[model samples]
Target: MKKIILLLTATLLSTGVFAQVKTPQPSPTSKIEQVIGLTDVTVSYSRPSMRERTVFGSLVPFGKLWRTGANENTKITFSDDVKINGSDLKKGTYAIFTKPTKENWEVIFYSDVNNWGTPQKWDDAKVALKTTAKVGTLPMKVETFTIMFSDFKMDSAKLNFIWESTEAMLDIEVPSKKIAEESIQKTLAGPTANDYYQAAVFYKETGKIDMAKEYIDKAVTMRKEPAFWYHRQQSLIYAEMGNKEKAIEAAKKSLELAEKAGNADYVKMNKDSLKEWGS
Candidate 1:
């Protein structure tokens, strides 16, 4: 009976130690993902409300680096290289820090992002890019902090920061036109060697012998370097087209290349096919 009471007391003590009471966070976390032109942009931060307190030149202060959000570091990521205020920023995530004056705000993208709120020792070497944005006042009061994308276009967009009545905007540019033109040029340049080879394989599987023969011949001619698999496919296509002489020639080439490449499977396959074809 004593042992049983002792076990129950221990169990109750353990349960008490592990018990937790859930409560709402003072500042909630937020994540925003947006596609500006061909580039992907993401922002993550915590939003702290004004709650009838003075925001600028008071709580946040002036001429000092602000974390730009509550709790963890405010981070922004870009999928492609971008330009901010005519300055180049490479593709990656960066911690956003800002220094606010009465008229203008200096926005910074820091290379280091792992921090609770701000780094213990500020390092100027870690600053990737810095640009100044003019501050504007909103007509009405804003209760919570917000970061948003506005004025979106095919190649550019505006990143806006709003808290209380203060507003600042950052102009961001992406290489949408350059990326699009490159893609269009590649498409207009016609099929590559691998493209022809794949088409030949598809046609051969679907019982289109004439088309397979044409595509395989183009693949073999267009290839910059000799490939054993291309020759093997060419041999198969020629054999299917009833060209025994060309088939034997291609099989011999394939066998030679396969041996040089040290591919035992292709070597054995070419030898078996050559014997069956009476070569």
Candidate 2:
């Protein structure tokens, strides 16, 4: 009989421990995974769709840190080195945290990737990135923290991380075209640097003039490149800055580069630009 009672007590204790623990919630809506270089990061969570109560202080409250996602910490997994808003993040998992407000917010990439909601695991040293709040018009209250890309370029893109109140923007670049251009200028400049013209094309199209200039100079310096490639790129930058004279000169250079390089296609393009300007 004593054995039976002891067994019953043991069983009850085991049940109690489990009863106090909560189970992980089933999958909900919204999922996003980003490849920062080679590593894969996943974000899976849900959000309440238009709660009956007012969502402000009464529900989510203000001036309080909220788990940006529906359950646990909004998770960010890094597969490779990431530069989040100029701050470097080593590969790892991190708990994403956000400070909510009516019109602004503070986002946190906490080091402690594992934790429950509300009071989170915040290791100061582990913070990989933190971004200042940005004010923008969001048409709807996003249920979960979400990231989307826009303004694409060869080496970088704008990542818009959005939630209630406001959103933040970060430059996501892989193998960093900025660095790549500098590398080319430093090591690849010489005759036929035009071979590296693809890198310059991306920089110019993406509105990175300083970067484009550095690379284009290398290409032009290559075997006295027809002013074509060099002049053309300069024109693009001048147009961007609304400088007509520099743009005209650049057009002339493009024609020269093309004729010298024996690329008839480029010369025709520059000729058209000059004709349009009646020059």
Candidate 3:
């Protein structure tokens, strides 16, 4: 009896391990990433097949909020702020929900993205942006639900949702021109004061006293307000150039500014340099 019980327990354990089955999900998850202009957009959702059944009106009822996908909430992420149907949306991840109708679909970007399907408790305040997209009849039937970007442009694109023979499109606009212009302006504006200071320090370290003096002078003149570190670097450059008067003058200014800014390190450094230069 004991041997028979042990054999039965071993059989059951082996069966439990071997009986686990893996099969294709009825609705498979899909993810797509796109770059429109300077922004990166990503969509993650589950795809459900029609399986010869009617979609849209019947399977997915009209005048109701949909998860926009099968199992989990459909999520869309943006690398930069974007405009959808003339409404501004911040840069972040959002769950996409929708209400379908024969003429149009109300697409919603929801702030909360942790729900399994539609939220049990819908909060209007959680709705980031809601826009209506006109429904169009597709020439060919789409067996599986699809979400994709179309009509690509440098600053704009269309987010298309197609299922069966119905299609809906949302226009997305990115700040490509604004970003590009800002970048161009910054590049064309010439180096900053810190750039000159760093160049001066590099030149000084490389034993190029002339270039160091030129850069340090430019750095000092560019500042609208006095910076102790900049003046300190200037003093060092002048001292290296064998100009005791200018070095002492710059060290004195650095000492004053450092004292005002409550920087003990710079104050001590400037005082030591001043004493060394016979100030």
Which candidate has the top score in lDDT?
A: 3
Q: RMSD to native for every prediction?
A: 4.5, 19.7, 5.5
Order by TM-score, highest first: 1, 3, 2
Provide the clashing-pair count of each candidate structure.
Answer: 0, 10, 0
As a whole number from 0 to 100, the lDDT of residue 1 in candidate 1 is 100
The local distance difference test score of model 3 is: 0.96
> In model 2, where is the ten-residue run with the lowest total lDDT?
47-56
Ranking by lDDT: 3, 1, 2
Better of 2 and 3 by lDDT: 3
- Cα lDDT, all candidates: 0.95, 0.66, 0.96
Q: Which candidate is the best by TM-score?
A: 1
lDDT for each residue of candidate 2 in 1-279, tens digit (9 for 90 to 100) = 999999999999999999899865442556677554343556655654333445546566777887775666667666656666666777677776776666666778777766778553446787668775554767767654455665655555566766554465666555555555776896764445655466677888897877776776566666342555566876766666676777788888778768878998888888887787667
Preferred candidate (TM-score higher): 2 or 3? 3
lDDT of 1 by residue, 97-120 (tens): 999888989999999999888899
Candidate 3, residue 40: Cα displacement in angstroms equals 1.8
Q: For model 3, what is the error of residue 176's alpha carbon versus the real structure, in angstroms, after optimal superposition?
A: 1.7
Query: For model 3, how does the per-residue alpha-carbon lDDT over 123-221 read when each residue is reduced to its tens digit?
Result: 999999999997999999999999999999999999999999999999999999999999999889988788999999999999999999999999999
Ten consecutive residues with minimal summed lDDT in candidate 1? 14-23
